[model samples]
Target: MKKHVAWHIVRACLLPAVLFSSRALADCAQDFARDNAYKPHAGAHRMHERKLPLSLLDGQWVPTLKQEIINTISEVVPPNATRITSDGLFGPIGLVVIGDRGWIRANGDAAWEPLNAAESKEILDGAFTSYLSFNRMSDLSCTRAEHNGRPARVYHYKMPSELQIGSHSEITAYFDDQTGLPVHVEVEDGNPRQRAKSTVSIAFDSAIAIQPPETAGQTPRAGNADPSGRRKSLYKHPPGEAL
Candidate 1:
């Protein structure tokens, strides 16, 4: 896994005047060293919940677009590997991010498929790469605070149009004050009305390898999952690949 033992330059997103000082940077790094160090291991895990924009689901088949999401349902692990899963509209979907390669355990016990196609970039991006990008701290400004129970700090940032979640404009993250591990995240979709909102939390991390259920169901393969099987090879990223 990627470990930052020394101080690396922080690519500040703002002007020098608002730049973080050396001491501040050190503190930030120290507070988040464990988090920053964990480039992701073969056993690390991540669970998140992201709500898609209602507009995207405005088609004839999915007309109503009720609040459905590929919700994450696991804890974030450290050091070795990470496995992520979500509740898809049809059933449940999962990704096993091991050895820097994304192996997807599509519905059923069909076979472990590798994400290597260009079109599968969205899945690859949202599955694991984005999870790594989410940890890039130099671009964010953080303040110390206590959230829930852990000694925590909050980092704030503005998302570009492409990175925005649905109609959200801002992103806020809560990290473990001591370990620097992210505990909770909130994406503000609306302000005045507080209509559509998105939130994700890192419930916990375990000191073990991530694995799929022993009795994984035996659902038949979909008649058509990217007819070209493009999703099987969408990306070639190890845990250490650049964001």
Candidate 2:
């Protein structure tokens, strides 16, 4: 399989921080907006996600990357610092971001490589925009429901063509009514050849410190000067899609 290495890292670590799909409903819009405004001083998040590809004949979902499973633990400190550890389809990966600078390491490597401008832009620019940006999609519907026995709001919407990964893509999201926080999200994308689906669940921690990992060296990876060159990533975000 052809892996979009950089895309994977971007998705595996940061995508869970951005979730949900919505538009139209005034209450949903307001609630989702509040979620976007949330930026806690310190906390930790745990996410688990599974992805599968669909077969044409029977519409059965099959494992494309050997039943890819992504588990991430992200911790944040004051002043926007974050450290994410992810066990992705490829292996283990880590990312750290402090202000405008970030570093990435893969496969339990000791050294952390700093992200270049273009690469950093690609990963961070939209990493947290999905929920806020999806409000632009034209057709969105919402309903009130219960999740985990708590009041919740549900939203289902199709991604805009420009943001789609395949012939079409759709998302369903659940938000906590009391807290205005996203609890779960599901996404499905497909084309004539195959279909893909990803589901993620989130949990938060009240206290955690996000610090850079100690490493022996900081040498750059060969061939990475070219942004398009093959490398590595984990969560596997598709190109051209909104985070």
Candidate 3:
């Protein structure tokens, strides 16, 4: 089994700025760092540390929002070593694996299946690597701002890799002006000529669980069947490559 880690970046841009109140903006920024920032398991190297204002955690909405984000992430990227990058609007734009050797990239219509897992990982790693590199080199900025009556923290980062040439990606976490919990996320990216935008709305007090699709009553393949009628892999890789 693959050990999956859930990672998602949400953004929004090019929209009217008059939507949010100043107070909301502050709250959202704090929540963004809190909900999204998490340390790797013990003994694991720490990548980044983001701190949240204590005031934001006092509201009941914080834990609610956190659970929603976690559930949403679990749906597309299983708990195995998975990395998901999206405009944070419509759906996932790309998914890479540390679980399997493959990946899936989206281009508006259907997703494109690459030739192999190595190719998929290469594209995902390249895109992110390029994004980080450009963010460091350019006038990239991230700030807490209000938009459309919601509090949000915006990220304006540059994309340097050839794969993302002429592209810009933005992420915004939307917090309710009255409550600190994030209600939605907006993400935008692509070239200046043509852009892809996505908005993801989160429902409070909702239960989102990640579970395997039901396959009840289905018989397992001859070679795949175990004594319990569950499907099993016919071949297993050596220990090191198992995941």
Candidate 4:
């Protein structure tokens, strides 16, 4: 009878271990099957699918406003630039090129020379992505307001950081009701002491290219002079001169 009791206790312990192992294996198999089945659906679900209805524009249209803002910003082709004056307006004031290397006219001559690439990169990166990330829209609330003499959607978004004194910042985006093209974006950082304001404007134009100048690979003109006149150093732009 004692031997029988010992055998029963050992059997009970073994049965639980066996059952637990089988259940764990079954759960892993089920997880694998679910992962395989959802692989195709995952891609489809990630895309933006819903279209906004026209009649919903009367009061605070949150989703439509958010989508429009995202679409406009995302459409900006990376590193797109053109010749602009020192004042930051596009024109033929001086030769300017933007790409892997940014170049500007040094002496107002037709000759295009390289700008300080590191400085330009810092400014551009800060102006675009860094600023966007610093003040991202946490909760988008839309309100109807007059934008450029037409009724448009004005969105209020919560500022991501505690440095901003106000609980939220306002983003006023003017969009064409029919075509959904964004005309302007306005953001206000609500501190009277804040000196810098963030604003980005988009313009559509057909002619923007970053073609290398004809003098890109040519030997330096100083090297072609008499050997005595040519400087021995290979450095193109020396210190104290603007790059």
Evaluate residue 32 in candidate 4 and report its C-alpha lDDT on the 0 to 100 scale: 22
Query: Per-residue lDDT of 1-243 in model 2, one digit per residue for the tens?
Result: 112453465553454333444343477656555664534532445445555644454454444433354455555454445666766543466777765777777644335767666655545444433322362343466788998999988877666432234344687778888877777888777766456777867666656565655662466445334322232232233322211
List the global CA lDDT of all models: 0.44, 0.55, 0.32, 0.32
Top-TM-score structure, candidate number: 2
- Model 1: worst 10 consecutive residues (lDDT sum): 1-10
- The clash tally of candidate 1 reads 18
Tens-digit lDDT track of model 1 for 24-143: 446544443335333344334454667543322222222112333435554434433445555543335555544344455544324445544542343333333324233222345668
lDDT per residue for candidate 3 within 36-120, as digits (tens), equals 3322221111111121111122232121121123212312222233334432212234444443354443411223343265544
TM value for model 3: 0.32
Whole-model alpha-carbon lDDT for candidate 4: 0.32
Each candidate: how many clashes? 18, 5, 22, 0
Q: For every model shown, what is its TM-score relative to the native structure?
A: 0.51, 0.65, 0.32, 0.32
Task: State the lDDT at 112 in candidate 1.
Answer: 48
> Best candidate, lDDT-wise?
2
Give the TM-score comparing model 1 with the true structure, all chains together.
0.51
